[model samples]
Target: MGRKSSLTDDQWVEIERRHLVDGISINALAQEFGVNESSLRRRIKPNKAEPKKAAKSLQALAEMKVEVDAKAKHFAEQLGALPFAKQQIVSDLARKLTNTSEHMASAAEISAASSHRLSRMANQQLELVDEVDPMKTRAQLESFAALQKLANISGEMPGRLAALSRGQPPEAPPSQEEVDQELALLLGSGGG
Candidate 1:
């Protein structure tokens, strides 16, 4: 036997919203309103008061907009989109909708695209925030590790020089030339 998957809160809400908005389908929305199918379907069938009421609600919904920019942007961040990619996507969408200029939906306060841009921006920002914090942690760890290495070198260095002065072969201090070579390599050939 297959296991039954329970609907999440969001799924239930969406189902109920659809049912309410579309005029409940008796067979499809039985669990949506916690009702019986046959009885509910009968009740839904071409009623005198119901159709008119439903029609009025539909008209209102048609005139309304849910304005999901905040949620969309938040979700976008949760999903991890790049900043430029987010802007490009929103810009393209805005241009498509506006059909005149490429910069039509450029900001969050302009039009319907503003909501979409905000979502994309928020998503991208979340990704950036997530990435940067980890990188900063890694950099701190690396810096601490480097300092530990330097401390170890400093500790051993005096003893090595003392041994050299006592007639053992001496290791030389790191020269400026070697340091310059290392810096050049680290900076890359282009100097960028």
Candidate 2:
């Protein structure tokens, strides 16, 4: 009585009867019939109810994930062609390969067991590369910034290595860090 619909009054009544028997939503019924959901709701829905919009959010998230995946794949493909970016060269003759093993680990058969072992080895390597070497007081493993300032001031790589080997911190050079450490030591040692 409120508005006209494509389906007749009898069809609307039957649709409502089916909806009751099936216990399905009017939107679902509309989707099943490939008709406008709003039109179907107006035609068949007897009880006024608010349709939830959660499905739209989930659909949007799915679309966002797809877009992210495509972008990542495209960037990875572009990066695959640039080989020089993957290696760090030291001493002009030796190069350290950085994570070329993603290809190996990505193999369809890199089992969880293998991954666990690989993770342990990787952690050990990271520690070795990042730890301050006790034998080499040159601060090679302390942090890259500290090492750079030491290299710039000392102008003697061999001496730096000797310093690191002696377990002495490479702090003789005038790094802002050294100044801060001096300040802290002075303040704490009651010399401030």
Candidate 3:
């Protein structure tokens, strides 16, 4: 008797495919796989044809038909289709309502939380505004006033210099009367 072969079933299937599907010669396969030509031929024999379901016996066909009909009848009687369909619609509506309510609740929560956060942020900004040093503001206002006074003095200086260059005495300081009249006009009182 020939020694048992170490090749697997998959290997045998590949050898068969190469011989039958690829149309390789069996002698070549026999030589490559180191198997006797007769053994290789036996291993590559065509598979037996499976029995066709369409070739069922009359008894089996009758039994199957009875079972299918009985199942159909049972399903029709037990389903209570109209009520089951209505229940399905109600269940779907209930799920939709639950989802809508949950979504609304989440939106409301977000709105409320955002509003609270915004209010806190606004308050913090107001607090920061309040924290501004009053002395700094007063210093800036005083500096602005000083700059305005300096600008007025500088503007009159050129006219004074021109008068001095023409050998005329520099313009005399404003008289108290003239100063008083200008102050009255600026104070919205009719100039006296």
Quick one: best TM-score, which candidate? 3
**What is the per-residue lDDT of model 1 for residues 1-192, given as tens digits with 9 covering 90 to 100?**
634435456655565466667656656777655655654444444465575565466557665534466677786785476677877887688778776333532321243333344445444433443343544444443343334334434434444545655999756656756644654453333322
The Cα local distance difference test for each model comes to 0.51, 0.52, 0.60
RMSD of 3: 36.3
User: Residue-wise lDDT of candidate 2 within 94-184, one digit each (tens)?
Assistant: 3223343344334423343444454454444345552344325223233433333333433433344446669976545466666557644
RMSD of 1: 25.1
What is the Cα-based lDDT of residue 58 in candidate 1?
58
The lDDT of model 1 is 0.51
Model 3 C-alpha lDDT per residue in residues 53-119, reported as the tens digit of each score: 3223434776899999999798666555659787677669879999987786566555555545554
Where does candidate 3 clash, by residue pair? none
Cα error, residue 169 of model 3, in Å, equals 87
Worst 10 residues of 2 by lDDT: 87-96
Question: Total clashing residue pairs per candidate?
Answer: 3, 8, 0
Q: Which of the numbered candidates is closest to the native, going by highest lDDT?
A: 3
Worst 10 residues of 1 by lDDT: 104-113
